[model samples]
Target: MADTEHSSKNVTEVSTDQQSNQSSKVEFSEEEEMLITMVYNLVGERWSLIAGRIPGRTAEEIEKYWNSRHSTSE
Candidate 1:
């Protein structure tokens, strides 16, 4: 019983780590970057609007990407 519980816990931890690693890969194509920049300049840090202008990305992802790059500049 203890072995089963411990193995289950280990499996859960590995799955969680894998999920995080998978989601952390936020790649932007050259076109996506250009559109992101255009929308950002036009809208001025309004992440949802910027993201809407560039499909295939959510507001949260846009915000995270923008903040990671430009948050220090602000």
Candidate 2:
């Protein structure tokens, strides 16, 4: 019983780590970046509006991406 419990715990931990890794490695194509910048220029930081124009991207993700991109440039 203890061995089974330990094995299950390890499996859960590994899966959780994999999920985090996947989520942290989001990549945006150059076209997506250009669209994001264009929309941002038109609407300012209205992330949801920008996201609406870019399929598969959430407002939070766009905001995070914008912040990271700008931060590194500055």
Instruction: Indicate the residue-level lDDT of 31 in model 2.
Output: 100
Question: Over 4 Å off in model 1, which ranges?
Answer: 71-74
TM-score for each model = 0.75, 0.72
Task: For model 1, give the 10-residue run with minimal summed lDDT.
Answer: 65-74
**lDDT tens per residue, model 1, 16-40:** 9999887767888888888888888
Report the error of model 2 at residue 2, Å.
3.8
Candidate 2: segments with Cα more than 4 A from true spot: 72-74
Candidate 2 per-residue lDDT over residues 1-74, each given as its tens digit:
99999999999999999998888678999999999999999999999999999999999889988987887652
